[model samples]
Target: MDVNALPAGPASPGHVLEVLRRGGPMTRQELQARVGLSRATMVERLDALGRLKLLRTVGHQASSGGRRAELLAADEVGRCAVVADIGVSHVTVAVADLTATVHATRRLSTRQDPDVVLQQVLSLGRELLAETGRANDFCAVAVGVPGQVDPTSGANTAPPTMPGWSGTWVHDTLAAQLDVPVLVENDANALAFGEHLADGAPSTTLLGVKVATGIGSGVVFGRRPYRGVTGSAGEIGHVKLASHQERCSCGRTGCLAAAASGRALIRRLRSSGARTLLDVVRQVEQGRPEAVALVTEAGHLLGGVLATVVSIINPQQVRLGGPIGALPEFVAAARAAVLDAAHPVALRGLREIAPARLGDSAALVGLAGLTADAVFAPAAVNALL
Candidate 1:
């Protein structure tokens, strides 16, 4: 398929593609009716997309009264997007298509060096594309970093824990290496997108709290991510705690992350040889009293911070996420604290307080969905193709 041959500056093709991606296979008549394009214009757009290998005729729909209509769908095999979710201690890489279907995923221990981590992610993405026989067919790359990302520059401007990521040009570097557009977002915000879309999150207002090696929060309002002015709106980890004394990786003291993060809990339990958050979680899972108490305390601290956020955002749902969120004790304590601190009016709006449904793959899936949306949009696709 020659991407350059595809028509540019037309809205119909992208609308058709998006319709097929979201609603699955649809008949030509259905697509025409939905897009409100004339029959000839719809046919022309479909044919153009087909020529570019972006759309395919999957099968024929059952005849309603006369002839069977051809069912068209997004062609998954034609193109793919690479998604990376970079955590403080882990990284997840995947290959996905415009339909938001993930093809393959690989997880690896994260490295402190940004170069090393990026190389691993790119290598894994390339391998997945090669394995799927879609080499050079990848359109764009999206990444989720565990820090405050400047949306315009794709730089980690205020990374609280990821010291190595400071001043790093994530999007530019990825674009230069992959020869494609790159989108960078905060990991928590990505997870919020994933959780909102994947789990059928009911509310127009949603909050995702990530209590991992570091702490962070993501807010989705009206089905859109609420990224504040500098894209640092949800850096809840840096919120100060009265009793916190531990020095944070961002060279601050008394921050929420310093006192209540998984890293902080692990540090307190270091004498037990707990080097990673997983070790601490394992201990909690085994019903270790010491580990349970520490995590539960962290949860209370996190909830105290979240209560203020709840009052401000008035989100209908608060989703617990990351490794620390998996523990029932931690969630219970956090819930209790939130109930105690949240304003009465805010509590009325709040509904569910549950664990994240998508688990570790949330950020990867969110990034893939975002990349597809940006790259496959009408104007963007036309310009690229």
Candidate 2:
């Protein structure tokens, strides 16, 4: 396990891949400087990677003197990753390259039966791969479900909505179906990872809040998802709201999700005579007092819950994602409430409260990153082999 004793030169293709994975494309000189390898050693690694079709010489850059240096980039077509987001109402599948570019995507309505849903996922994944003409290049698959996952076993532990999914061997099941290693993650955490990878957030501490059919938060500290003991660290949606009597999908009363999620907002809007979220948005745009009031209230409730999260985690940035989080009015109101409720210290270092840059595909991109990590990281790949 000694770092220095590990294979060097062209033999350390994995290490070179890891460097490219983190730092993007670089010249041999730059790679050597960054990865602490000699020039000859770096060239050897690059040549091996090129031979495997994992890296390609994209272009060249002018050097201080002498010949131009060849710039190398990942050969995305040589390897692909799949990500599946299993939500309450739907399942979304996406295929991406090692650089995290989504090439193809598909979605299907979710079923009550976990096994049926998983089978549908496999079918859709194959369809996407065929559509992208990347069936043979696919290296790994990652799934994000709405629940706590045992990282070691890849088993769902206690997802409130996905009743029969608990105790399911997700990794083994999907791996068997796809003939590739699979990694399962919590949906919220996956979204956070996607945001981190896509947006390139400067802060090492990031909080991603997803306001969909349910409200959940994901925390990334020190560039890694902070899954707490039992892998339920970011279940902020289940936090009890102040003295409310609304019942959550978990059969608990007064959870934040029951009070302020997109479902809750939709329910309130429907009760107030609005037909859909679009209708509510139109009404608010038209200055309909009732619609504006309702959305503002939901935003306030969400921000109130976020206040507690900010106080505890004190993340440098808070990114809103999912249905409600993507709405401009909702974001405005939430930002106002967060500013009013969060502690001064937490607010002092706060960079910005904004919508997720990746929008609806955040979870899918995160799944791709997870898949790449499982396939390319030295330790994870070694375990797989």
Candidate 3:
């Protein structure tokens, strides 16, 4: 159910918490099977978790020719987290429970100053907590920003779209302001994790591509993001293109994002009154000849880059996400492009191309999950006991 590296018993409270958090409602017998804990030991584990308000008993499961078993789930009603998804021009904030369910959401423009933006996040979080009557029950604050980050430190190593953001102490500032565990992640990685953990998700290993103001991506394998050595594993936006010659925000020419990203589209379509990424999507959906032609080219460029990625990683699917990622035409175009460019061997058994379903709030949902996992790891849970 969850990533369990700990011994499966009361001795490892993290294992028990993580299992319940990811596996959802299940009888003690079913949970015991997954964690390999004896029934007697399971009682002790559950009791400890219960005291910490980390697990709970829901309604009873239907009896199968025997006594009905009480369904137990990770308790989320007692705690909450504040999460934010930061994009080029806006931020989506939410309050989520231990189970990563959003309770309230708000959207705000991205402030030019990081401090102001983070302050806004804190203010919004406080407001949400008060409204939800969990003002003091929120455990952490997390955000997904679009840039290369030092995952552990949560500081940007470089800023492509955001000028003067490289020096901001994103994690430390949030941690200090909120006085709780603060997590910062690449927006694409957060989206990938959200997609990976989605209910009824068809693939665990996949690529999450963001094609909004900029193009970025993340690789998730077995529910863990592959962030390379310095947390820049999936910067497909900056990969050079033989066919593209435009300049990128990163000061590079011939990058995929320089040619195919939404910002690029806006530049190319300014004469046609395209303003934001939404405008670009609207144009494509309206079947504007110019927009369709441009997006198709961008889609092919994206797919061409993804083909190389697929060859190396062999992902089950390439999940297109972000604002433009919601478009069906772009999804189809990318799918066809991948099929046309990728080797047959790599394409074997690859699932059909599909638009990401998590929508615009994908990063927020993921940050909440990450918040739960990190703040309640085995060691943290055991410490609580």
Candidate 4:
């Protein structure tokens, strides 16, 4: 393959790298076939990527009767992302490769102040990168907060659960600390993205609801999160319920989250000495009468919001996630309510309501993936080459 022979306008090294990133290792013939490029063009692009240390030969694939083709893969070690899943109660920091392979991880109790939380994520991210021997390999940092973010500016806006987080300039602060690009996402949206990537990058739309300290939802449509015009598309926590009069963190009288969130249940059973949502889950599993009743009711409330969500968007799969959402009893109750409340037409395309596949790590996985995609876009690849 001659570098001088390469044409000027349409040659894309990114395409080859993207194919390898998404589909794993591939032979030259497979790469050429998939990209529909001439063999010479493919070879030139591959060689260029190799010189830039962005692609490498993993192994050789079997051949019919000719020389075996070497399998090419993205040199994920050359670039990675630091991800932080900032929950209401905890912070999970991890370093992941471009393929979303987690290299190192750490968790800490969340801080109440916005700046303190940002510092915790940055410090932990740096520590994880060093532990993974990838101190300078990361291209971006991603953080998923349990609150709403302004889409264009990446500022926290009117966060109900996270005190002192509202109007915080999170993206700029993290970017300044890490000296790299920063992506801030809502926690539930991160979970949905994580589920999407873990589920073999499915083409169908998905809805993931996180029933943690608060209730929030994430939606995936056409391979992108539906963040809506205001970037608060999935703020189901503030959905007003006429029947419940509990005061919500958002200063509302009857929000569904106040009535049905994990925190809500904990508050209801505050006298039982349950410190975390997992304790409540254990009680539910052990068939404790009070825990079962509270979780079931919470599921019913969540299902009401989900019924409206399903009716409007009609996602193919609905994933219940977080500490409380994964419980079988809660899922069953939510499923029944969804089936009862959703319109028949909306129900036609729906699949079974299932627990989130990634469990508590979904947000971290999603943040890593989101970081990778942003850093590996065509323009970024061209710049690297």
Give the better candidate number (1 or 4) by lDDT: 4
Give the worst 10-residue stretch by lDDT in candidate 1: 1-10
Model 3 agreement with the true structure over 1-385: per-residue lDDT tens digits? 2223335455476787778767868898888898887787777777777767787788999876888988988776667899998887888899998667789999998856867987898899899999988887889888888878875555675456676556447777777766678778888988887776673463468788888898889888866778887788998989999877898888879999888899999999999999888889889889999999899888888988988888788878677887776577778788888898887888995775677767876677778877877887877777665
Cα lDDT tens digits for candidate 4, 193-258: 888887774587899999988888999887778898778998899989989899998888899989
Worst 10 residues of 4 by lDDT: 2-11
lDDT for each candidate structure: 0.80, 0.77, 0.80, 0.83
Q: Which stretches of candidate 3 lie over 4 Å from their true place?
A: 1-10, 22-24, 29-42, 64-67, 199-203
Q: What is the lDDT for 154 in model 4?
A: 75
TM-score of each: 0.89, 0.87, 0.90, 0.90
lDDT of 1 at 16: 73
lDDT of 1 at 238: 90
Cα lDDT tens digits, model 2, 34-142, are: 7787777666666666655667777888669899988776665478887888887778888887667799888887755777888888888888889999998988888
Of 1 and 2, which scores higher on lDDT? Answer: 1
